[model samples]
Target: MLRIIGFLLFASFFSLKGQNVDFEYIDKVYVPTIKSVTFHPQGMGIAAPVSDVEGNIPLLLTFDELTNDVKRFSYKLIHCDFDWRPSELMEMEYINGYPEDNIQQYSFSSKTTLPYVHYELTLPNRGTRWTKSGNYLLIVYEDETEKFPVITKRFVVVNNLVQIEPRLVIPANASLYRTHQELDFVVNHPKLLIRQPAQEIKASVVQNGQWKNAVTGISPFSFRNQQIIFDYQGKIVFPGGKEFRPLDLRTLWQRTGQMADLIRTRTSTEVILFKDKLRGEEPYFQNRDINGRFFIETQDQNNQLAADYAQVVFNLYTVEPIYDKDVFLLGSFNDWSPSPEYRMIFSPEEKGYILKKPMKQGFYDYAFATRAKKEEKLDFMETEGSWYETENEYQIFIYYRPFGARYDEVIGYQVFNSKR
Candidate 1:
């Protein structure tokens, strides 16, 4: 019975793929060209001219047919739901080639200076409105018939007023510091506080890791230019209470000797293990009876040499194996998938589950989620720092430039103050 259900599920998944349009050059060149192109000040009801060269108007595309004469060349802009599913928000614009038609079109005459194309479109004010601020794609198709190459460009539309900018402060000149050393930096403007209630702040730090919570003893400091002090006196720990550290350019060279040796040895077996040992001895593996292993992996196919995949390995221990157990690995690694990836069986002897996934090479904050009957809990053994629930510090930067100006040639900038 289970086998029959599985086969049906597989067939349904493949059937969905068949419904998609088969535009040969869609993903190859068109997608890249759209992505490489940029638009300024993007948002709802916002319109900005598209340009390839920074200051000038964008060049109209011109295509020459090698074999057959090109007929009825046109384009359309399709807006779908957040998931790109069939949405009421979708709209199509006709790009007519010559002005002779009542429909908008580009005309070429003897006076035409260059062989090019031009198009302009204004999105409708009505229909399903964009509710959330996020990244979206603008798909440009050469022909409404879906026969020619189609291009897609990704853009961000921020609909909300609240903005958050976070920054990390390390010593400007010095790089190396002894393990468990105390460091201090000033948090200026609307002073930053440990994200915890005043009375329970200390207890939270002790229960979680010290690094997870901001250091205490900050009240005496003035809010005008608040000072933040961090004490790494216990052991070297990754920030943001993440289970694994990102192997990016900044920290790649830092992994040395025993750490390097461990990664080299265990990479094929489990590539996500961190080499440097934490100061006090603690059991690294958990969920033994649950039959699971947690680890990290990268998503990038090219540049496997660079840190890309960070995943968790799960080893299930039960004889009457649990089927379809929704195991979620949470850490600073995943954005704390309120819900995350499903488990997969790797090998028979390794009869547990693995959540091997790729991550970009950068520091992240994450945790794990497991279900027992009807309740959910975080793996405290793998968790660090307590959520004090206090206001944290954040930095704000505003960069401005005129329409026909270079990005770096900033006309002005402003910094807003915030506590947390």
Candidate 2:
């Protein structure tokens, strides 16, 4: 049964190989050496998704190469439709400047045991600027070749043609009331005209800053007063996931918030975190969390471009090893995507699961996520637990496709917090 289920899940992901766009990819790196990758609005952290096509706001792309030597890296942009496939528009139609450019801004790690080169690039600069408001993919590759991209991150550009007002409520379904949160929104398009609310207008909603399970292809059940309403009967529901687990790596010199031990060596520094508890047995408790977002901060330095990196070690103890599922340390550090580096391996000697990986110094919010080979859902039941009152962030995106248009335009974008 598990094998069959696993095969189905694998097939579903790769089925879009020839499709125009893929939204399932959150933040992914093609190579193993690439770490501490981040792509967001210049001053905004990973939580915010506001970018202006007027060149008022630019995205800051940064990543670290573990290799000792520096390499020439280049970047390009792909304007995607609302579905996240490459749009039909050509390069000159969407970009004002050249299509591609080399990343000239970078710095080497300072006063750290792990020698690496950090690269940073601001999007829509003088060399390249966007001309349209829609979904986009920022790809980074070595040298001038576009064959194999080292990193691919998604971002959005909005011109704000419409206004979005969103509301969160307990799901109408009795079975999901305790563990689900539903979204109801209204899109007011005063200037833009939509021919069909059901077919021409499309909406998507994402919860807790993760796009893995975002709800898309939303259709309005009713329209009135020049507004489309998305108050679905039992749709637009999301898991009221528990508050994220916090890790404070701002400073490594001494034992910090959750630091169990800090081992210093001539070549590198390693940090050991205390064991984590399984929350399934306990009642739900509300805690302040960053909703799975990450922010870069260095203790000795203010500029994140030159922040020191560390080899952080994570330990999660279990009474007995569960052989059916795989445990992973999930967060924005790896774009909330599953990878071998963040997987925890069970150890009989310690009676726990352990993982040690190199990460840039920062404050990160993560959780222990378990996935079965054949299962489609990422279960937090045994680790983080589900609760209705867990504060989560939600984003509403509305895209419109005119009758004669070739691509979907982002007519409206808004983000709201459920706790508020």
Candidate 3:
């Protein structure tokens, strides 16, 4: 009787874990059970990807579950085009091995108040590999049917065959001089002959390694001497957001960088961060920043796989809440997309906004932002200041879809920094 009850409870949990996944976005976590999800090129930090196509480098996928017991999870890959849409190829055409595989790597957190399991998997494992170079979506599901996925994230598989020359500088327009930076680039395809370069070539530009505001479907302004040049003044301008605020939660024994206080109890530990204020009117102070990217690291544990979790409390200072706006704590730690989970609530008693969230032990960079009611745009300048001289990273991607081809192929990629 006890065995049957245990089996039923296991089945019930798996049923709840099966949630529909949408592939339209870049980083998405479907199930509420999952937390602290990260996917990137192994040892390359968060913004860089393994660019080699010969299987010399592999990608890493990691996540944690709130439950104490371990669970079975499987993952599959979906090939996408340069525009992040599904490609025109079949599963067998892109994947050299099986389409789906199990996640065999995981471990439980050690010497921590929060009891949970951390799972890590590598892409192009022994049973799975990619045959093409382009965009990809890693879909993680709880069952073999794969009817619903618990998490989905986008990754790049690059085969750098073409050279790209990129430049970052102040914008030519005087109006945007104090707030924006400009990007210029040239794509040189010496080995591959692209007929009708204007119609076949597509260019995309991303700021701070984020896809929310990436400029895509751009054509080159000039084509000369086997070089496609993109020097548009108005189209390539990006807002230079101020330096990101850092928070350190790598240890619990003593307060670390930017930590206001640390509270410990029998069940869990909470780290309260110092109150932050609006920087809209502040001058542009040059400080070291990662261009809005974060990496997971821990000093308490020997490795990140053994790191523990902590409940982090973030405080924002304000005399009173804005009448028609809502504030959010945004950063790469939350995929730079502010959902309701990261929304800040006004504390009338404290006269500030407070957001308490569970986070892994690591160094995180974040910013405060505001959005008006029923609005889709987030106003970073309302909280974190924007300046033209602020250092930022820009990445340029060149794609080609020939007249006979059915998929968009990445022909060139280049990264540059402004005032680095």
Total backbone collisions for each predicted model = 43, 3, 0
The TM-score, computed over Cα atoms with residue i paired to residue i, of candidate 3 is: 0.92
lDDT tens readout by residue for model 3, 179-227: 9888888888888888888888888888877878889889989898888
Question: Each prediction's TM-score against the native?
Answer: 0.28, 0.91, 0.92
Candidate 2 residue 21 C-alpha distance from true site, Å: 12
What is the alpha-carbon lDDT of model 1 when measured against the actual structure?
Answer: 0.28
- lDDT for each residue of candidate 2 in 1-420, tens digit (9 for 90 to 100): 999987986675454233324223345787888888877788777655558769788788888998678888887777788777777776767888877788999888776777778889998888999898888887777873444578888788888888999988778999988888888988998887777778888988878657678898787878986899988868998878888889888887778978888888787788888888887666778888888888878886666555667778787889787669999899877877767777899988877888888877888998888999877577888887787777888888888888888777887889899988
The local distance difference test score of each candidate is 0.28, 0.80, 0.80
lDDT of 1 by residue, 1-420 (tens): 999987986775445333335432111224211211222332311122122112122222222211122234333333222232323321211111221111133322111111222233322112212332222334444543554444433322322222222223332323222111122222222332323222211100111211123232222222122222222323222122212322331133234221222232233222333322221224322111100111222233233223322232333233333343344554422213224343333344644334555332333333333444355543332222312121222211111122342221111111211111
The lDDT ranking, best first, is 3, 2, 1
Ranked by TM-score from best down, the candidates are 3, 2, 1
